[model samples]
Target: MNRIQRVQKELERANADYLITGTTSNMYYLIGFSEEQMERPLLLFITRDDYFLLVPKLYEEQLKQFPLIVYRDGEDPYSKLNLKENSNVLIDDTTFSLFTIEILNRFKPGRIGRASRILGKLRQVKDDEELEKMEKGVKKAEQLILEFVSNIKENMTECQIERKLKSFLIEEAGNISFDPIVTSGPNSSMPHLRCSDKKVKRGEAIVIDYGIKHDGYSTDTTRVFSLGKPNDPLILEIVEIVKTANEEAEKHVREGMRAKEIDYFAREVITNKGYGDYFIHRTGHGIGIDVHEDPYISPDNDDVIEQNMVFTIEPGIYLPGKFGIRIEDEVVVKKGYGKTLNMLQKELYII
Candidate 1:
């Protein structure tokens, strides 16, 4: 069935009278209509048997292919909904408060609920077209990494590398999924550190975590690099441990397993080596239209792994005031196994 039909089924199962959402990823997924959200109200209304887009006159022609209800400038768009009071309605979690408040004041939905309850599960198991786009995104991300590595040299500031990576992503991949992280030496201990002007030096570990956007999909991966042999032997040991953790987690990814099991597989490897406390953050997160999504591989999430669900498996160890090591790879669950999408070698590279 088509996406709208699938959601209609969900609405049926939910016993919801109607499903309403604004300009968001959820709306884009359902009807292929996406635009930067603005004050102008653009909404999608769906029911068990019918669907329509309500947009401003400015978008009337742009979205002509779909069923549309258009309002010109200066018109109160909310009045067009004509929703009945005490109706059962589901709203997108991403809907703006301006619209939501109007909904509550006007419609007084008998039961207001979040659309994520239905959209989240449907989005977790990607269709073939999404997988194709995601695979292309992964290849673009790998290319960006290779270009970054080829241009690396000693004494370059982390900000310089970050700028170059950004340019490459915009030029080659069309956009960036998130800000590229280029941390060195002690700065590497911060898993989400913003790039700084500190010049990378030999014998200090460097953590390069980045992602790019390709055809509306997101790709994320992390790799460790060093200008030369690290000054501390512990750096190499930690890298190996993190790499093994990433590997074990990927190896054990199977359909029907809890999302937390993936975290345990990686955490088990790190904790066994006596550095569990340093392994901060969840093992991984689902990556798709958004850089982060559902089916997160975290210790507290019990979502089951399902076929065609794509996510990441990253494990790390940080030594305060010293350095950090993280290895990450994106994987897609198949019939009964998980396959890594990244083509770059996980082993630490000494330049």
Candidate 2:
């Protein structure tokens, strides 16, 4: 079913009169347009009987082409609605600003239902169109990674590498989903370390974790490489262990399986290698409009995996004061199995 049909069904089931918001993801999910709403709020007033999209007066001509959208000037959008009392309003917490929330509250005397988790649940399971967009995003990200590795040089500063990667992504007309992480030597141990001025030296491990956004969809990936020959046997050993863990997690991922089981699958491999403590974070998280979404893959989560859900299978072993190795790839859960979206090799590379 199409996204509009799915959302309509959910709205009927919840007995909501209308869904209001200015969130770009939800707007794109419902409508096809994902362009930035300049200065003006893009409120989607969805009801069982009608779908109205209110935008700034400046964008009236552009939005008017959309057959279903009922354009309204941003200065006074509510004037077009003429909302009735006792009507149920569904608001997305992520995109609803304080001023908008106050305006919505005035319409409904009682407390309104924040459709934060509900929208997340809907977005977690990708439809055919969303999956296709994400696949394109994955390919773009892979191409950018190849470009980055091919131009890598010895004795280059970590910041320089990050700048090169960012340049490549921008050149492809894609926005950075998040800040690129370029850590070398002992800095690799920090999972979320930002790029630094320190230059990468010979025989030092360089970790790069980054993502790109395409058509409102995101693709996340991580890879580690050394400037010269693998000097530390332990680094090689840990990289192999992480690769095994990541593959094992991907192998067991499928529909109807508990999210925690996937985490355990990877954790078992790391623990068996006597580096469980080094694997600090969760195995992965759901990837879609946001890099991190619902039904997180971790020991604490009990949500069952469903078909069309895409998430990362990243396993890492960080040895503080020494180095770290991490292998990550995005995957989508299939009916009876899972398919890895990233095609890059998992083996440690010597640049």
What is each predicted model's overall lDDT from 0 to 1? 0.89, 0.82
Alpha-carbon runs more than 4 Å astray in model 2 = 37-39, 66-81, 84-88
TM-scores for all predictions:
0.93, 0.88
Q: Give per-residue CA lDDT, model 2, range 294-319, as digits (tens).
A: 76999999998999999999989999
lDDT of 1: 0.89
Per-residue lDDT of model 1, residues 144-172, tens digit only: 68766878888899999999988988988
Clashes of each: 0, 0
Which 10 consecutive positions of candidate 1 have the poorest summed lDDT?
76-85
Model 1 residue pairs with clashes = none
C-alpha lDDT of residue 57 in model 1: 99
